[model samples]
Target: MADPNEPVHVTTTEARAGATPGVTRYVLGVSLVLVIAIFAFLILR
Candidate 1:
């Protein structure tokens, strides 16, 4: 018989992989916003 704990581990792994793209997008968007803000500040100053 299969162990119940194994399924939980597998599900967690799948969930993390599924969220990778979302995390990457969030990071990229924040980076772009920071870059633009910095550039605007420099230009205005």
Candidate 2:
């Protein structure tokens, strides 16, 4: 039998481990966009 009101504990390392790849990908995507925009501005100006 499971307790309906019981709180489950998640380890910080386990939680962050899953999210690390996603965060890395997001940062890379943003950085690439910023680089392209800066280059375009420099070429146009």
Candidate 3:
């Protein structure tokens, strides 16, 4: 794993903005879906 102190690099303008817009929103939506899936799996199991 990489150290947190090291600066990270990204290639997106939306990443710099950091708001939940455009590509950012797509990433967030996928993350939210994964979280919900895990929660449902745990509860159902």
Candidate 4:
């Protein structure tokens, strides 16, 4: 087996081919905030 610590190679094209993980995290954070706001509004009413 190869060394696990060896650096893997990624082509430039491959690097740009996928959706960024940051965007997904941001979306999830926004949705969670919205859900919390909605719950708070309902509770306050």
Q: Each prediction's Cα RMSD?
A: 5.5, 4.7, 10.9, 4.8
Which regions in candidate 4 have their CA more than 4 angstroms from the true location? 1-21
TM-score winner between candidates 2 and 3: 2
lDDT of 2: 0.87
Candidate 3 per-residue lDDT over residues 1-45, each given as its tens digit: 899999988767657775544687788899999999999999999
The lDDT leader among the candidates is 4
Task: Give the lowest summed-lDDT range of ten residues in model 3.
Answer: 13-22
Query: Candidate 2 on 16-35: residue-level lDDT in tens?
Result: 77555568888999999999
Candidate 4 lDDT, tens digit per residue, 1-45? 999999989987697997565788889999999999999999999
lDDT by residue (6-45, candidate 1, tens digit) is 7544677676775444688888999999999999999999
lDDT of each: 0.81, 0.87, 0.86, 0.90
Give candidate 3 misplaced runs (Cα > 4 Å): 1-21
Ranking by lDDT: 4, 2, 3, 1
